[model samples]
Target: MASSPSHLSSGSDLEKREKPLSELTLDKPAESPYLNDALEKRVWRKLDLYVLPVVSVFYLLSFIDRTNVANARVAGMQADLKMTNHDYSVALTVTYVPYIIAELPSNLLLKAVGPNWMLPTMLTLWGIVATLQGVVTSYSGLLACRFFLGLFEGGVFPGLVLYLSFFYPRQRLQWRISAFFSCASLSGAFSGLLAFGIINLDGVGGKRGWAWIFFLEGIFTVLFGVVSFWLLPKSPAHAYFFNENEKNYVIERLKDDGATGKDASVDAFSWREVRKAFMLPQTWILGVVLFCDGTVLYGLAYFAPSIIQGLGFTAARAQLMSVPPFAVAFVTATISAFISDHYHCRGLVLIFSSVMCVIGFGMFLGSQSHSVQYGSLFMSIPGTYIVAPTLSTWLANNAAPHTRRATAIAIGFILTNSGGILATWLLGALSPAPRYTKATIVLLVFSVLMVLFSALNLGYLWDQNKKKRVIREGMDRSKEDPSLGDKSAWFEYNL
Candidate 1:
């Protein structure tokens, strides 16, 4: 063999070279500053103390404003507006129309305007519209207000997801996302209790209980919006509590964990990237899986009380009955997120939870007994909720570059909401009462499909991991042996 370079021939120089290798290969590698538990705990506490509460409250308001209409309907909103059953469905569909259309652009604006300003502004605008809903005297007026509510509230969820990405790494993000999303479940249960209280206020100042629903909830939303602007942190780099050293440590540690810094430039959206996203086997696979999820999700939200009311409860009692499923969902979602993070495996959790949903839906479809059917509904709700945040966090983790991740998340939401649209028609008034057999069947079909798609996605990712390993090995070997020459190697994540 040829003699080593003169620098490496010296014993001291060789030791210096070997020291780094020894350190890297050691059983306990040197821990990064950001990885320090004390430091991470401090940051986590800051986020928990300051950020989570604000975001949770904001999303609570958003969820209340968006879905409380269902409660309003139960409290005689349909009668007040002379809205036929079909018209009520139309109003629900109208909100989603603008919601689906505005999602992508709104998230892009969230990136530009910063969550501190954008989220609160969006909330304020929707609050104004939601309050206006209380004043509507005609079916057309309710439609107008619903459309604008969708327009404003459209930005809330996805914007929050993108915003969370700025503050935490992918693994830690799951719990927060689940916690935030649990607000919807919280709102579902709380809305029932609140509607119970507000309905008792029906004759107060000549406003109906339904009007009080919009008025009080809208006011709370507006106030929370104002508070959010003041309380929310701008970004990790700009987090007011952390020192300069801490900020740099956070940014660098995230980089080591495969997350690019907030300041790093993401590739602009291009047809090429769009094609890549669309063609990636995971994209369509997740799309279908999420589509199924959306169907069950919105179906339960829109029709749960209706189903319960048909089971012999009065309207108010039916609303109360809707509470348990959502409560179960909230608790299960939080637990699932923590478990998924603990294991660092999302796909298995998703598959298992989705199967729970299938079983729940199957029970609902097959059973005629009220208690058994309702119990199934409860199981289905939590299982579906469990899959959602995990699926979202999984998608966010797999996407590279900030812009691409944003695009992928937005696309996933688009697909999911499209399923929501399908839900509107599937669970229409034409469906039989007490049973809603058509709706139940549709839910069962989609839940099974969701399981299948999730399985397919996991398989694809496993194969992609294998291919990536092979390519990386080849590249390393090529570096060591020049005879292999220079060849570029690249691979895509399954989805």
Candidate 2:
């Protein structure tokens, strides 16, 4: 039966038979194994397991080191050191000075050295300085340590954001960034609990309770840093767990969302890109939002225990009281980030979170009853924190080309640090004891401003999208060829 069909065919017959195979091959496209839904989910899970904890630990320590001064102040740091002049607030503000100045450059350096080496090393350095803060005798010494601590810790947040961007796509980033940031809230709660234990060690080795707070936290930071160097993945291209096909899929999927280039090459920053970042309206809007959010965040972080004490709680008890709000913040931020990611919506969630903050501040301003006021604190912490990570992740996702994204992130971070400075200065003169009415009012106003700005931003983005659609339809009407018009597509997502 085969002999009849297999006899040498004429060229015309051969061509006719070959045509169907050729058409079949072209018509039935090869299903991409790389884009397998199950595989992508698995990869994401692996990345989450590996990266989230290192980031959480790193930021937890960084946040603790940064804000433990608040705890220390309550633990008799000011009274023992004769810091009666309210220079502690000055010291706190000074920390952000170096932090703002150092942020971009430190992240650039992280690019050069690689995260595995640079991050852990920087963490260790700051940990040492944080510990040294405990040993400072003179006001000048504390100032010096604070300055250096800011300098070293400045790299951690932006560096971690950049690091995660290398591994995850834009939509996946918000929750991871939120998870990373929730460590800050967790640190607040943990620091309180940790301080509660350490304060009991008062007079150990002749050190005050505040000194033990720094000493123990700093040492823990150093230990975690050592662990991080080994555990942290450098980049997706170099990740040990994924195969080559998986790596390529990760890279290609990111390209679909406008990110390009493999993870091995570092994107260098350009002045042109820096200018583009500044020109983006979203950048300025985010700056304002961050400024407002920071006022609430830092005001509460820096002054919460003091405010609690003013409400008639003892110092240790105030520290304990501060824990519940931050604990609420930790849980709320995580839940917000997860829901934001699951829905693939960023702006709406951020606006809702900001509104929650406004409500919290309203309650805080109106109420004097201890339980009601404390309940309001819960709203403030979670609301402030929930917006921040989403805001940051939104900025990161909307910014394009690696270099521009990095610059935009740097600008956003600088704005955030500037907000921290503004927060400190705004609340600077508020009395340590009695009511913090002035600070409370400023925070409430800022929260309202954030809501207004967020609404304006949503409107602006909607208008831009409408304009883009009009432009696209006009082009389609005039086009000779659909393929050529597609190539000329100029629409971009508004941040």
Q: What lDDT does each candidate get? A: 0.75, 0.75
TM per candidate: 0.88, 0.87
Q: Please write out the lDDT profile of model 2 over residues 342-392, one tens digit for every residue.
A: 886677888899889889878877987877787888888899999889878
Model 2 weakest lDDT span, ten residues long: 24-33
Error of 2 at 392 (Å): 0.6
Q: What is the lDDT of residue 211 in candidate 1?
A: 95
Which regions of candidate 1 deviate over 4 angstroms?
A: 1-34, 261-263, 267-275, 474-495
RMSD of each: 7.1, 8.3
- Cα miss at 427, model 1 (Å)? 1.8
Global local distance difference test of model 2: 0.75
Clashing pairs in 2: none
- Model 1 global lDDT (CA atoms, 0 to 1): 0.75
lDDT of 1 by residue, 428-464 (tens): 6656677888888888888888888888888888777
